[model samples]
Target: MSNDFYTSSILPYAAIIIKICRAYTNTQEDFEDYYQEVCLQIWRSNENFRGQSEWSTWIYRLTLNVCLTLLKKNSKHHVTSNHLPDVVAEDNRTFDDESLNHLYNAIKQLSEVDRAVILLYLEEKTYQEIAEIIGTNPNNIGVRVKRIKERLKKILDGKVN
Candidate 1:
């Protein structure tokens, strides 16, 4: 894509970029840094975009890879427990705004891969789409979503909190 196309067609989805950045960072400075980095990566890779998928899809995958690489290079403080149980107890549902905050917090408590899966799921991306972006099979994405949802419930129920 040309510079004009990128600025005009892709830059308009700034909110999507910000949301992706927020998923990858915990602070304003970190968020800004990741956001800028993702933008730069997108710009640098624009020439490699082969148009096999929707522009948004390509951007999403590229942005996620960029964030994952950066997170890998940084500290390991955000790594979620790998052995968290897949089963969760019932009767702990919180559907209010507090529930939303709890959801975000629980998301932060997940591992980087789990975080990416849950974030994309919460964003309402389909399993096939998520699989494409994450370079996994759709069936694997479905299974991971189920496991992550249970994990999130466990986190919200004070099991991991």
Candidate 2:
């Protein structure tokens, strides 16, 4: 994509990128690294976009794939982060809401695929849209989402780990 297209996409898509990357990362440093890597992948794959879906949907798939890829790669070399998880947004101004932080923390506890499902569901993507992005059947999303929501509730309520 052209510089202008990427630039414009970055601003509008910043929240999606941040939330997805943040969910997969445990520290501020790792979050920043994931964010940069996701953006880099977008830049590298500029020519591969086939316009078969909306730009936002395409971006969602790209962000999720990049994060998932990096997440798996890190597992082979996993090291505990020195930084505290709640301390992640201390220096960042955008996601400072207390409840948002709690929700994100709870989200981080979910299985990776469940995290992606809930993130897309929260974005208000239709079941079909989410299914397309995640390569699952549309009907499966509804059932998974229902389950994920219940799991998130239990996590938030301090009843489950």
Candidate 3:
């Protein structure tokens, strides 16, 4: 992707990209990789935008799909090796609120679809918009969102693993 196109198409939506990438990744290295991959995929798929949906909506869908795909692939290739050095962040930054950190950790426990749903909900997307992005019935989004909230509460309360 050229610097000009990336600056025009992606930099404007960097926040959305960062939030989605953060939700899907555990470590800084993984986060950087996912962020790069998402940008690349968005650039590659730019030509496919048919204008049926708003640009933000298209970017959201593409971001979620790419994250989910990479997550599934990583899970299948689960590799553990003590010989590998541990990754450490060069910048030492921490969340100010423990509860917020816990909340995010809880959110990470959700199923991929539920995670996407909750993220969209947190972003204040309409149920219809979420359903359109997630390929679900609009009416079902409310029920799912309610259930997802309950699940998250349980996760935060140590009632669910």
Candidate 4:
């Protein structure tokens, strides 16, 4: 498929893509590498997209699958925040954004499956849709999201002090 496919279809979601990449990988280089890999994978698999879901949802599944597979195969070297560009901390003010970042950081501490659920939840995905993509029941997603929210709030409250 031509690059235009991504330019038109997937490029609009780059920020979410980047956030997901950063949430998984620590270093800028590693994140970029993984982001490129995701793009390539999406492009390669574009033709096979059977229109079973929204394109973004499909991309999210592909991204989660790719990142989880990579994580299972190789553990990335943990990097301190100093190594990342300052922008990682940008958009990180305001109670909600700060709370969201804290929540994201805490969510990163969970298993890959949990992390995916939290990310989808933060993205405002419905439990049914999240369940559909992750192959879990909607009821379980509801419970998991509630637990994730409580965990995030605890982390946020701790950081506020």
Best by TM-score: 2
Enumerate residue pairs that collide in model 1: none
Which segments of model 3 are wrong by more than 4 Å? 79-95
A best-first ranking of the candidates according to their lDDT comes to: 2, 3, 1, 4
In order, candidate lDDTs are: 0.75, 0.84, 0.81, 0.74
Could you tell me the lDDT of residue 64 within candidate 3? 94
Model 4 per-residue lDDT tens digits across residues 14-131? 8778777767765567677888889999988888999989888888888888888776655554433312234554443213666566555565556678878988887898999899
lDDT digits (tens) for residues 1-161 of candidate 3: 89998999999988878878877777788889999999999999999999999888999999999999998888788763212222321121225676665666667777789889998999999999999988889999999999999988887676863
Question: Is candidate 2 or 4 superior in lDDT?
Answer: 2
Which wins on TM-score, candidate 2 or candidate 4? 2
Worst 10 residues of 2 by lDDT: 80-89
Tens-place lDDT per residue, model 1, 45-122, is 788989999888888888888888887777565554433333321122223466664576567677877888887887
Lowest lDDT block of 10, candidate 4:
77-86
Model 2: per-residue Cα lDDT at residue 34: 96
> Which parts of model 2 are misplaced by more than 4 Å?
1-3, 79-94
TM-score for each prediction?
0.79, 0.88, 0.87, 0.78
Given candidate 3, what's the lDDT at residue 72?
A: 82
Query: Candidate 3 — what's its lDDT?
Result: 0.81
Each candidate structure's count of clashing pairs: 0, 0, 0, 0
